[model samples]
Target: MGNINPSLLHVGSTLGAVFMALMVIFIRLKASARPVTLRKIWIPPLGMSTGFAMFVVPEVRFPWWWAVTAFLIGWFIFAYPLMRSTVFEERDGLIYAQRSKSFAFILLGLLLIRTVLHEFINRYVSIPQSGGLFFILAFGMILHWRVYMYKRYTRMALPKAPIPQPRG
Candidate 1:
């Protein structure tokens, strides 16, 4: 990869980000179309966990404090909007994710923020390290968001007790 051009890398990563954004939107729509399940709620974070292998690469390593700070930022800050936008409702004895009007905008805003942060962070670190840090951040966001979704799904999925009838 010694021959790789900087401008090309920029263009490629930009395109990749756009593609990922589109995929996320597409997946969200498809997921909403189906009844929410515990399996579905848990799958994303589990699958995303595999990305941690990138840390094995020396170029991607960062200080433990950096990792912790990134994760906390994602957990406390980035996950908030996602949790708010995601709501599970029982419909016809099945749980469905309620569509939020602000979801797309929230995603776009996050992507913009991440892109800007990526540019800023890249100046201070190698591309691989930056990627790893952002990966940790994203993992934290997804983990917390998925946990919230799982809790909501289970709550909605549980059978409700009937109200007591008043005796005349």
Candidate 2:
């Protein structure tokens, strides 16, 4: 915002969001029994990408109508992901089992923002001092989960096959 224009910011942020979305979606899709499908691939990325767009709102002081409009636009686009399907076998279910965990993370964040619509999660919007603690915590979570996910995905420690009895 210091030197960047809105259009540039928009494009940059949108692209960045898309890139991250792809990474996260890839992680989810790799957990599948089948190869990744375009339709399924887009869903996680769409939700994540929209949420990422919010970071690009320059100075964080949005004009009232524009802010509300942005909210509704993103809301409409991502709303469907909030609900679960008891019927559709196509959808991911269970925590970290399918893509459900990613969706759950997204919806939880969106719901938190909805609760704090008048303000953000923190009281102060324009303040940046030390985010080390946050980064440290995030790092810990990533490390813990990355190990677990890797293990789970690879079935790292299955019991060894019992030795076959000698056939006389």
Strongest candidate by lDDT: 1
Best by TM-score: 1
Tens-digit per-residue lDDT, 16-126, candidate 2: 544654665566446554533334434543443343344355544434554444445444433434333101122242223434655646644643443344235235333
lDDT of 1 by residue, 46-152 (tens): 99999999988887898999999999999999999999999887778888998787888888898899899988998998777888888899889999999899887
Assess each prediction's global lDDT (C-alpha) against the native.
0.86, 0.40
lDDT, model 2: 0.40
Stretches of candidate 1 exceeding 4 Å from the true structure: 161-168
Residue 161, candidate 1: Cα error in Å is 4.8
Q: What TM value does model 2 have?
A: 0.32
> Which residue pairs show backbone clashes in model 1?
none
Give residue 76's error in model 2 in angstroms: 34
